[model samples]
Target: MSIPPPLQLLLACLAVFSCRHFVASHQESGDWHCDPDDEARIAAEFRPGIVTLDGRADDWSNVDGFEFPLRPALDPDEDHQYKSGKMTVKALHDGKDVYFTLQVDGDYVYSKGDDHKCPSVALMFQIGDSATYHNMGGCKESSNTCNSTNCRGYEVDIMHFSIGNSIPGRLYGGNSVNSVGLVDMYSWNPHCRNIDASAPSGNDSTALNDWKGAWWHSSFSTHPGFIEDDSPYGSSAEKGIYYFEFSRPLRTTDLLQQDAQFSIGKSSKFSAAFWYPSDGNPWHGSAHYTISCDWIPMDVISGLTSQHKAASGNAASLFAFVLSTAAFCVSIFVAYMVSKNKSIPFTPIDDRL
Candidate 1:
């Protein structure tokens, strides 16, 4: 005797549905599996005054760092070219302040124009729980304009440092810009003339050519504070690798500049990107290239927070629960099918009947 076709179809449909659910769940798990290299746990080192803000590699010898491979622009155009490089980032906190050392493997292209030279680097960070996109907060509305409001309602902190004394020379600046809020910018460039112009060269070899520091809010039109603490130096032996060291008070009373808060056990999301001029001339000729990394989970360089531990436990528990539920449902269906097939009584064919 043959089983009914309807019953066979029902069992097949149940099996298909179970497999589909399992695959969908698997895909959802990938969203949370951050790249191992992108994620880092920073440990606290209480050594104040040891890590000086001098552009030298000697101070960072003991600190552990992560190497991030830099790729060309995701979308290359006529103005932007494709380039490859690597950046090594090291971080250590002295209980009151966090210090970062960034080393780039490229030539420090120095360009001289009518009145200035050009060489610079910028480090940007997302401070709080805001912004949907990691690269520049949001998309541009037009070639020359960006709708600051729609770009993601978060602020990005930028520490821009440049060398040389061009007519429009780049300077050491601390800035915070938001899509919905006013822009806060501060700089130590003599070109801005916000502060008195000093000689273009530092007393020591590690100092910049000309430096000025000032803080601004709402627009780049005013200066509020004059604080210059960041330093940069080029490598003689390695040629192009430039090292920059930055340090600041953990918390500041200054209202114009944004201060990033760090807790012992808590974590924050951090990302970085870089820009390089295409030509040696600061004013004309060469195009520029830019690249960026997706946001990574960064653990505070102190101790593991209870929240992080709880999150890990919750993820494991949720995965197990889902797996167990799927298995239980499948088992029930299998048992029902077996019982229904057994219940179909066998009828012996009798010629007299």
Candidate 2:
């Protein structure tokens, strides 16, 4: 039994990526292995197969400045195209930390785009807080959307996955450059109306570009000074394992905790909600904005893609397989009963005339 060089090559490539693919040549009729006429999933458009994400923690939370009590969500999908990994979360008195245990499929393709340097994921943390902070262009106020203004809060202070920043794929400031956080407008001063109500809305006018480029213009003369600019936060950075620590001061649990949003290429459409409780030093003096993020090696597509497969594809297929198997047995039983009734034994009757 000698394996051909081509077959050997294929196996070697598989070894480079993930050995857990379970991609046996025994799919379908199983003639796809050595029949020379076999056509199967592994044989069709399969290049060691790139992996995505599956499995998530059913529930997780953190209390004020208390240690996070979380159970890592292991890669439960053993035979999945992409295997999931473990995630650990904890909250500290001043900030939070999240750690992910990832071993990429090794077959995943490096992302391509303008931000080609880093692979990133956008993020959004709940909305409708009692107040929204607008931190942009050296200012930290409260608002949802900004107008050409590069404010501090307009951009959140977070990290994510697959971003284009220079981080050698999965490291600091690498991914999590998504634009999920909200952006809003603010005036020169703290006053809500520092902006003129009669200002035009086009970038063509030199005057307009100079004065109204607060939300976006890179070099507006009147734009606030650039110091510790937070353009990464409020954007899509939710793909990483967010190590949320600290509980809110009071138990106003009725309020929405996290209205996280995610978007691709500056368009904010992908995201979900994240909720936890209030914990941390109640008398830590000031509620300083503190957050931490680590884009551990990205092993698979997480968040949305994961939710879809788990809730739709995998669950439905397994359910159907079991149902059909049961139905087939029931049909065989009925056929046997019918044949038995027609073949009942009886004594022969002899008629004499």
Candidate 3:
């Protein structure tokens, strides 16, 4: 997994110079404390083909969502919470991949090619055993000293989507490092974030983004399609909800253990974050709003596949048919037995006496 010396040096220099991620911009506040909502658990139902991942909520009308107030990531004070509305998070899983939708009410705002001016969102999940929701995996190592060997068991997987440079309803993120704006990344701590396969050591050539996402704002009247020419697709400050859709495979071939592998019937810890340019003011990375101050639990529900469901239905029908046939045969047998026994009319008790 080690990279060549020259390439490693080049990547190291890039990391030291220009690869600081947005999550790494966390500004330390005083002691962090949180009383997470006990009922704030997301369930990814086994709903195959129910979601289209088109950044639209019409298809997710039947799916249930967990809503949370968007509070400042650094300061969870309720008084300063986002005034628009709570974020509604919905999730579903086909047998192959898992999908997520994040919807939040916000005035339409778009700044083409400028992510800081447009709205953005990110999803973080626990990958290592000891990773905490705080501190982006909460590794104790400083940026200079942090590495896979030292920060072991503190990995977290992250998927960030910035709609600035991306076309509305156009999919982004993949196996390559060059994603539009939706990138799949992992980290040991805020200072130790890296794109998949971009780690200094344990460089996994096979590692890919493993994430695809699209975005849309309810203000946009034309959701049938959108092209790059449709920059600033809708009017600014238009009242509407913003929809972000994303999907990733349930499992990946990530030998470096950077990806959070999901399994049906299992539980994982995760959190959601949103960034917005309020009042046309560009938002900084540390100034975003988060769903919770701590990790929220997510469950990948196990469900029967379509084929299995069909088979179960057939089995039920067959059982019903067999039971009915058996009942009819038993009735016939009872009738035959009664006839064979020779029906005799009982005489009155007085006559018998």
Candidate 4:
């Protein structure tokens, strides 16, 4: 019961067409299937004055970190994970500002004047209620049609750091006088990204990068600071962990709503990305690894402990009780003295009249 030749050819053509359409649709919509771990949450506790923001992980010893395997941002296949190790993310807040530390194990590799050859990292945060982890905020509009007015409620705040132009342990970002590799940015989608308050047409006068960060490696020698002359600061191919420290205000003066405002005891959605030059090859813009296929939950916690609050409450109550007892005693003494000394006042008025 073999099919006829013409019918067979027709059936083959239809199968090929259906396969092509399926592939195209998958690429267009970016159909993502991810089961984010419920326990994988990053907590930014109230740890004021715990870290120095010098890109050193020693100060963050007591802070807890969540580890996630780094997978390709476009294709998250476990077999293609970063060969070195998983990345550890730690965060904390000081009531005024939020801090982050991204630690990834990798061989030291640096190339002066080329950020693509060096390790880099970026953080994307959901700034709008409709924003999503996919497609960088998941704005539907194309580049031409995407703008603040049209693509509202799809903003995601981004902070990117390329260590090639940045000195190890040196501060970058939020400096209007010069441009380091660390930059503050926002995006409606991957194709429509810009500096805060900036656009394709022109730069806004009020635009300011309100981010500060620094980078370091475990192989580097201990030093107060390193200048630009310290190129290739550490030996290449040395096994070590890279540390990227970042900080920004919990809330910014961004009337444009280009920044993510974090609140104490509240949660926010964010994702982290890492770009590494594998085998000495310069990585492209889109070739990077991410923590998860979807956004990760981050909690900004308060500083006060339950025990501390209870102690304060008990002290206040004791003070109030003592003050009330002293007042009662004084009132009773005054009444007794008045009653004993003054009884001739009421009859005098009528007698004189």
The number of the candidate with the highest lDDT is 3
Highest TM-score: give the candidate number: 3
TM-score head-to-head 2 vs 3, winner:
3
The alpha-carbon deviation from the true structure for residue 135 of candidate 4, after best TM-score superposition, in angstroms, is: 0.2
Clashes per candidate, residues 3 or more apart or on different chains? 7, 74, 0, 0
| Per-candidate local distance difference test | 0.40, 0.23, 0.83, 0.80
lDDT digits (tens) for residues 79-123 of candidate 2: 321222222322111111122211111111122222322222212
TM-score of 4: 0.78
Task: State which candidate, 1 or 3, has the greater TM-score.
Answer: 3
| Residue pairs that clash (backbone atoms under 3 angstroms), model 4 | none
> lDDT value for candidate 4?
0.80
For residues 1-353, write the lDDT of model 1, one tens digit per residue: 22244533332233233122211222211122212343443443444567755455676787777766553323323234334356667766666666766666655444332111343444444543463223333333422333223333343444444343221212232221110011122121111100111111211111111212211111121123222221122222224465555554555443322324456546655544444454434422222222233554555544244346668999999999999999999999999999998896667789448
User: Across residues 258-280, which tens digit of lDDT does each residue of candidate 4 receive?
Assistant: 89999998999999988898788
CA displacement after TM-score superposition, residue 340 of candidate 2 (Å): 0.2
Per-residue lDDT of 275 in model 4: 87
Q: Which stretches of model 4 miss by more than 4 angstroms? A: 1-31, 200-202, 285-287, 305-353
In angstroms, give how far residue 348 of model 1 lies from its true place.
99
